[model samples]
Target chain A: EAGVAQSPRYKIIEKRQSVAFWCNPISGHATLYWYQQILGQGPKLLIQFQNNGVVDDSQLPKDRFSAERLKGVDSTLKIQPAKLEDSAVYLCASSSNTQGANVLTFGAGSRLTVL
Target chain B: QKEVEQDPGPLSVPEGAIVSLNCTYSNSAFQYFMWYRQYSRKGPELLMYTYSSGNKEDGRFTAQVDKSSKYISLFIRDSQPSDSATYLCASTLYSGAGSYQLTFGKGTKLSVIP
Candidate 1:
């Protein structure tokens, strides 16, 4: 089966600029998530979507970060007025269902560098 | 304390040695435990998973979960250079929603010297 797919393997932008990352989850996956992984840290959940509706976004920095998963198959994460501290890897993951362990399959991730 | 705590180790070991990695969690509600292996510039891949407490072995990898102690462990037997990578431990707790929340550790880096 095809794994999750992410676009723009790497990105570099100046602080205060805006950037967006795209992701395509595996077919038939009903749950999708976006996470941010900083250097020397674990991936932290930014948002989660069940189909086209949002399941959680409590940790998301709404003032600067926004995400959408329209139609439930593809997702986009945007960071406006990016800060130097916002540099990190953006990861996308998906699961077929929410039962039991709900093992997530992840994409290669989009690396961002804010200068 | 963090929900999950792990030693961020660049542990180096000779080939054919036994490697043990562990993580501790403060949340007793966590019932699902998983271990993931990640290579440089690649996303994490699930290596092992166990439900509740007990041990599950696959190939040369063994996963142990002790809910009473709020600890989980992964053991690799006869470790090889190919096994060098970052290992992440994750735990999840069931919620009122159909899904659960997964919390991950900082990950332990392992290097098997040839």
Candidate 2:
């Protein structure tokens, strides 16, 4: 089984610019998550989707960040007018409840650098 | 206090030594405990998972949880250079309606010199 796939492994943009990251979750996985990991900090959940509908996004900054999972398969997270604090790795993870627990498998992540 | 607390150590040790990493969580509702290892520039991978307070061992790694103390630990025995990475401790509630939000520690960086 293929693991979660993410694209644009690295991106560099000036502050106030826009950037977007994509994620393709593992097949048959019903839950997808977007997390932001700043240097020296742990990954913080940005959004979570269960089969295309968002389950949780209280941590997401609505003014500058937006995400979508269409057709319950692929997801995209976009940061508009990015700030310096947005320079971090965008991690995508997927999980299933087959084991009666939430065991997530992560993608390599897209590193963003806001100059 | 943060949900999970860990010592962010750039800890260094010689190979074949034993390593101990720990975390303290504030949420008593977290029923699942996990340890994840992340290599530089790579995403984290699950190293251990356990429910209830006890110990679970796999090969060179062991995970222990004490719900009463709200403390969790991951011990690496005969540590190898390849084991050098950032270790993150996480806790979450059991699966319910497919909603599982994991709270993670800041992570402890470990370096094992060959």
Tens-digit lDDT track for model 2 on B1-114? 899999999899999999999999998889799999999999999998999899999999999999999999999999999999999999976435657888789999999999
TM-score of chain A of 1: 0.98
Q: Which stretches of candidate 1 lie over 4 Å from their true place?
A: none
Candidate RMSDs in Å, in order, are 1.0, 1.0
lDDT digits (tens) for residues B30-92 of candidate 1: 878999999999999999899968899999999999988988999999999999999999997
| TM-score of predicted structure 2 | 0.98
Q: Show the colliding residue pairs in model 2.
A: none
Each candidate's DockQ score against the native complex?
0.68, 0.65
Error of 2 at A95 (Å): 0.2
Which pairs clash (backbone N, Cα, C closer than 3 Å) in model 1?
none
Which candidate ranks first by DockQ, i.e. highest? 1
For candidate 1, write residues A1-115 as lDDT tens digits.
9999999999999999999999999999988889899987888889988888888899999999999999989999999989999999999999876468989899999999999
Worst 10 residues of 2 chain B by lDDT: B92-101
lDDT of 1 at A52: 87
